[model samples]
Target: MPASASASSTTPAAGSTIHLPKTSESEQLLKIRHSMSHVMAMAVQKLFPRAQVTIGPWTETGFYYDFDSPEPFTEADLKAIRKEMIRIINKKLPLERIEVSRAEAEARIRAQNEPYKLEILAGIQEPITLYTLGQEWWDLCAGPHVAHTGELNPQAFELESVAGAYWRGDEHNAQLQRIYGTAWETAEQLAEHKHRREEAKRRDHRRLGTDLDLFSIEDEAGAGLVFWHPRGARMRLLIEDFWRQAHFAAGYELLYTPHVADLALWRTSGHLDFYSESMFGPMAVDERLYQLRPMNCPFHVLTYASRLRSYRELPIRWAELGTVYRYERPGVMHGLMRVRGFTQDDAHVFCLPEQITAEILRILDLTEEILSAFDFRSYEINLSTRPGKSIGEDAVWELATAGLVEALSRKGWAYTIDEGGGAFYGPKIDLKIEDAIGRMWQCSTIQLDFNLPERFQLEYVAADGSRQRPIMIHRAIFGSLERFFGIMTENYAGDFPFWLAPEQVRLLPVTDEVLPFAEQVLSQLSGAGIRASVDHSGDRLGKLIRNGEQMKIPVLAVIGAREAETAAVSLRSRRDGDLGSLPVAALLKAAERANLERGATLELASPGKEHS
Candidate 1:
């Protein structure tokens, strides 16, 4: 089993009688959230009449409202607001929508002395609309609200938090207070939401990274730049080693590309013209421009265009863990999850059109195998077909789409067809892996492009003595390695699987008398290719064991006088359980077996496959 995944210890209880429906999947939930925001605004204004409600919108999971208020809100204010909201809910006020002209809406705002509303009325489209909650309040909106406030459950909603926000997200504009809240159809679902939120906080990768001494985002080096510590680097090396081995086994040749490339190369590839917004500003060098690459695809295209190729070498699979940098706005920079500089496990397949189906099938197989290795067995797959406007010929588009569908059907994996969701250049397939917390993160993508080949005029000599453009398929399993590392960190809650643990084993000597034996045992374990270290800090055995547990080491070896005399060591397994003192040879054999098999736990008493 690929590391059985669940939010068991860190999320909502499995038996909780609640179903949190996605906002897109539930119209009622959307309405509830939209109405909840209005209720919160009403509550705030009732308490602070000077507070001006700006915008209140429904989000995927909740709702938020920005208010230009005279005083910042406190936690106590949130509590008071909640009480007032529920009181209004108990009144069962009817919600009514009214359509008016821009002149009338502006007149109403002026009467209410709301300058923000007047400004909003000026910018909105004609056939202006407003929603009224009973006879009390009204605001500009395009609403699909419930008939009455009674439809909302007071117990099912809660004000989450508040923070400062600039009006329209502009720094030059007046800063406003933004209040965030969540609403559901039932209180049970609210409880589940709270549980998940708490769990997410506990498993936050930023916190875990620092606590485990894994990685850091140094203030001096700037935000969004990761500085991997020794322990974190070890795990990254292991991941990369496994990735290379898997790619090689799947017939992918690794490539190394430069971090900066000639700006003309990007222009030739159409990125300079189309993707300049995400790119860093060009630097001038020797009166010419130097561009920091935000993507590796153009470089791969250059390599294919480097030399003439024959038909026999049609399918060339090149993979690279290439690092690229892009400009992320100040507030958007996040720890690993969203970064300015990161490595992408990117690969491109240059194959003949006739070989598209086979190559796609192979890629599907490879994707599943690679993802499953990291314990991601469940995937949400989407096949995006050609859009209204695209680059390739109609016949070629049909052929490429058919190839994708055929490969998916052959692979026997169900997928959702996102009609017209593909890029203008071609069709593609996207895969999102569900983590331990059941949150789906977009990771793998396979796009079949006919434009890059055409733009670069890539060609290969066919048997008929004519040159034909080869199909360009861009794919990435780990879309961004840094993001994936963060996801994996949270997925495992920093308790990495045994095979991937940075510190596999720690040897604890009960006293100074057993130090020599512990060192010998550590050497034996290290010699067997196991990551083992001994505690030499002169701490007591209890402290050593506590430290090892805190570090989440997979195994701990307790070497006492008795064990040292018997040439054995007592083991406590984090994944498995306490194993009685085993002979040095037995311990070594089990450690080697676990390391080789990539098993979840030690092979303790028996030699068969083991599970934690």
Candidate 2:
């Protein structure tokens, strides 16, 4: 039996629930996903005849299909499968949908000797549908596929990779070979997708982290625990400093919370029942259970309830750079992007219902200001409404959703709506910033939660001396500091701006005679608060330049006999080509100004005239 079957057969406890996105509502994404799955299934069957199809579905990125094959797929196999898929597209086969009774579907699946299909048929409801890819192939599916295979451009599709996936995503289910592919509407769209993939690979945080010697995840320390090297730590400190300054400017008071708390606090927040799976198991602390926190909201709430106050203390915006831990399954960890431990730049606001919209708007404005400083200006916003299994009352849900809508409108920003997609606790606004290559990454979220206050019986003294519950707004600008660091590293392609670069200037001496002058210039640069280093290896000028360039040093200053006598230095920059000689004072001033202004490159134009 597949791992998925083993996991699914033993159902959860009675009344247990899981959140999943339904395909019925997102018709466009669903059709693209369903059709892509069929294409993958057909490709796999064509490449490996012994392989029997199981199931495939579309995801946010693209579509993936699973097969129960005796032989594990290799990289070469994926290429051949992609070629076969293109051939199928050239045939322009019609994807005709046929509805059949359960009995008929079972008969056909059994006739084909596909046990997986038979199992799928048993689970499907009435009005069973099978989509036929021309005459040779068909799969059990309820699809809104394209009219014909010709509608899919052979040039617009690509087969990505093969991974080990359980038959139904459960680790215990039968392990199957999953083939992933992406398709778009036009050839240009396909090209753009490929470009984006290449860009993402180029900007992969793992590669940058190693090349730049920024951070690492050690197997000895256990997976998903990040170890920040000296350079990475310095950058993180700079970021933290900036974050603190911004929060103070935005009128937010800071807080510090413990990493472990009593298990009862989690129960009070209702995380014990609904979110225990993702949480670390409790530890025995003097006959009581204590667990490491996976979120900072509960701790912040406890601080709020530590002492009661009047209505004048309505919008208490408190922020923290709290680190939390959660248990993530082994194969799911990816560098700093998804980690088991991370520091969240979390903030919470307690305010009246009437202040919800304005609070959300302030958060939006702050998010934009902070992210834009890192050169991420373009944004893709999403407002998720109430889910079916939400906890808040209908009127409260409506009010919260309206608040988010009003805030978004007031900010004059366009956003997509994910209907019934909010967390069980509240509605939310998720913001994904577009990187240099147009890839979107979710990094910020502002959620209006009504469940927590009610669960904890949180109250503030009203103007009339009545106790009233204050609404809670949870927000995080950089969802995780480590993840944001990785993204920023990739965004600049490891060529950090002058203000953020690990070493802003590297002085290279052409020969032994120039070493003293190089040292003098380095001293001047360092005195001006510039990160400067001297290449004391005494290597050749060419080799020194090559080393500096390879390390992605922003500015390289060269000293020779002529420069030594003239008190000038030859300059070269990564963003700009070679700049001729300049006086030491001029170089220092430019470096200082660039660092202060956070300029991408130093402003060292060509020499105006030769020194007299």
In order, candidate lDDTs are 0.87, 0.83
lDDT tens digits by residue: candidate 2, 1-612:
000101111122123332122243346546755776787788788777889998887865568888999998988888888888778877888899999988899899888899999888888989999999999899998778987777777776778888888876778789898888876655665565566567678778899899888899999999899999987897898789889998999999999999999999999988899889899899998999999999999999999999996789889999999999999888788899889999999999999988899999899888988897899877778889988897877988888899999988888887889999999889998888766654567899999888889988999999899999998999999999988998888788888887788888899998998888888888788888888899999899899999999778888888888889989888887887777778889888888888777778877544523433
The prediction achieving the highest lDDT against the true structure is: 1
Please give each candidate's TM-score. 0.94, 0.89
State each model's C-alpha RMSD to the native. Answer: 3.2, 8.3
Error of 2 at 52 (Å): 2.0
TM-score of 2: 0.89
Off by over 4 Å in 2: 1-40, 59-62, 86-92, 147-156, 184-189, 393-395, 604-612
Error of 2 at 405 (Å): 2.7
lDDT per residue (tens digit) for residues 366-479 in model 1: 888888878888777889998998898998999999999999888888788999999998999998888777677889999999989998999999989899989999999989
Best model per TM-score: 1
Off by over 4 Å in 1: 1-17, 118-126, 169-174, 607-612
**Please, what's the RMSD in Å of model 1?**
3.2
